[model samples]
Target: MTPILLIEQVLNGLQSGIMLFLMAAGLTLIFGVMGLINLAHGSLYMIGAFAAAAVAGWTGSFTLALAAALAAAALAGCIIEMVVIRRLYDRDHLDQVLATFALILIFSEGTRWLFGSFPLYLDVPAALSGPVRLPGGILYPSYRLLIIVIGLLIAIGLFQLIARTRIGIQIRAGESDREMIGALGVDISRLYTIVFALGAALAGLAGALVGAIQSVQVGMGEPVLILAFVVIVIGGIGSIKGALVGALLVGLTDTLGGVLLPLFFGLFMDPSSATTIGSALASMSIYILMALVLLFRPTGLYGRA
Candidate 1:
């Protein structure tokens, strides 16, 4: 591959990694602080996409659409927490998984009912629709670059939020000892709701941003959600720092493997066979990385023993 092509692929990897971080961050936070295994997290992602699509279509404003997506997802998360999730806090993991899985069905069917079976397309805003020249004479899509910037900014913001604020202290305390915090007069229930809604909002924002590039449709979030889970597992289930590192590692490995592996194989074999075998291996690269990591760390890079 040419230098420009390599640069582009690296950027693509970075973009993919950052987006996965957005998904995984919320997941890790929820698990770490609330001890909830929410299978319906992906449904929240889908809700964001649909909300953005619907609002954008009606208002013809991308900004407004994004706001709507965040609001809708957060509201939905709060409602679900209040009505169902709160009850599951003390339940076994199996029960939590089953209940959230049921929620996935409800969300999927409800979305289909409202949006019909067709996919919704979100147009990239006019201002960000074109490509920009990068440092190495490489032209990159402006919107994708924006995603990278936004993702990084959010990461920084999250770090600050969790490290510098009063809420952050409370969150950390809750994670360490929920019962102690509650005994000290903290409204643990309200805090849980806030964290859940915050997580949902993050997922929703990811879905909305990604929907502009990919088709907005029912079940789009499942594949991403699965990847997000891999990210958290590889990063360490309760570690945001682990999520960031793991996401970037998975993204780079997957993207580079897909491009470079085929080229490497083509040197020794027929182009067709090389392409097929390379693609297959490329798809499995991240899982292989995960297995290797687990073999050593077991609990993941940042997970506690």
Candidate 2:
């Protein structure tokens, strides 16, 4: 209702968008570079959350938990790429989809077996457990602020890596033509593995970070995965900039719509009815935004023709 409350909601939206960017960035990277549709990317995200939760429970160190998440997810990604995904690269999209879909089931059941059906709680570190005062006397959760900062830092690092690093050139080449990259002695298979692992690591990082704010539970990644797919579709497959912009747009639209729509409708209707209608519309806002964007720019904002 108030401007301060609106600002807080905006910040929350930004944090949510940042997490989505983390998830979508990897997805776009994998599809862009490898031409593979990995339905199991969400599995990697779940693995990361479980890894972080388990390690945090044992060691009581958030830092170590994060490292464990990155290592576990990256290792899982490497293995999946080598043992299963490698063979599917040359196959059609249907085959890739089917195989990855199977991987999702396998990962979910395996995780449930290991972690059980109960959700694990990851406590925010003592250092970041409280709210911090911001400009205009607004206070926000320090952990969420950290998440936003970390996400933005990762985004910058990814941009630099793709634009300036040697591996980046090879990745771009692979995206353009895998055969040419192989002809150049760049070891296309190795590049693919590395890219997939990197993508998985990012997803895992997102899962670990968000796990603190939400429950770290089995099959936690599926819902986020759906949103991430919507993100990529809105942003354009394989476009990092588009992912960032689209994610922010989705996040802001979703959060603000939920908060604002009820108020807007309440102006002319009963509170209960307004709340019901607003919640329904808010839930569909991101998809509506996606459809509008696609209608105008099929390739998405920042996507190449």
Candidate 3:
């Protein structure tokens, strides 16, 4: 492959990874701070996409669409946390899983009921619809590049939020000792709701960002949810830093393996067989990477032992 093509793919991978980080960051934060296993997290993502789509269709403002996404998802998250998830904190993971899985179905059907089975499209804003030339004589979608920049900025913001803010300290403290934090006058329930909502909002933002590139439809978040899970697992269950690193690794491996494997096999075999085998193996590449990481570092790349 040409250097230009390879670089483009890498950029694509980076963009994908950044979106994944958006999803995984909230997930890691939620789990770390509240110790909740939220299977319905993907449903929140879908909700954000639908919210953005509906808002954009009505107002024709992409900015408003994003704000709608963030608001809808966060509000939904707060409602669920207060109504359903709050009760599940003392329950085991199996119960939490079953409950959240039910929430997923409810969300999917509810979305379909409201939005219909047809997919909605999110148009890139005019200002970002055009491509910009990169230094290596590369042309890439400005929207995608913006996604990367925005993701990175959010990442830095998250780091600062965790390190500098009073809320950040509370979140970290809550993670280590929830009961103790509550005893110290912190409203544990309020804190949990806030954390859950924040996580949901982040997931929604990811959905809105990605919806521009793809059809906004019911069930779109499930695939990304699976990848986010892999990201958290590989990065450690509660580590944002780990989530970012693991997401990039998974994103690059999945994207590049799909592209390179067939080419590599084609050099030694017939094209058709190469394509079939390469595609199959490429699909497994991320799982393989996850397994490799778990082999030696059972806690994950940045997980505490």
What C-alpha RMSD separates each model from the true structure?
Answer: 0.9, 0.9, 0.9
Each prediction's whole-model lDDT (CA): 0.93, 0.93, 0.94
Question: TM-score of each candidate?
Answer: 0.98, 0.98, 0.98
Candidate 2 segments exceeding 4 Å error:
none
What shift in Å separates residue 166 of candidate 1 from its native position after superposition? 1.0
lDDT of 2 by residue, 197-242 (tens): 9999999999999998898998899999999999999998888888
**Candidate 3 backbone collisions, by pair:** none
**lDDT minimum window of 10 residues, candidate 3:** 29-38
Candidate 2 RMSD to the correct structure:
0.9
Clashes of each: 0, 0, 0
User: What is the per-residue lDDT of model 3 for residues 166-251, given as tens digits with 9 covering 90 to 100?
Assistant: 88999989878888999999988988999899999999999999999998999999999999999999999889899999999989
Ranking of all predicted structures according to lDDT, beginning with the best and ending with the worst: 3, 2, 1
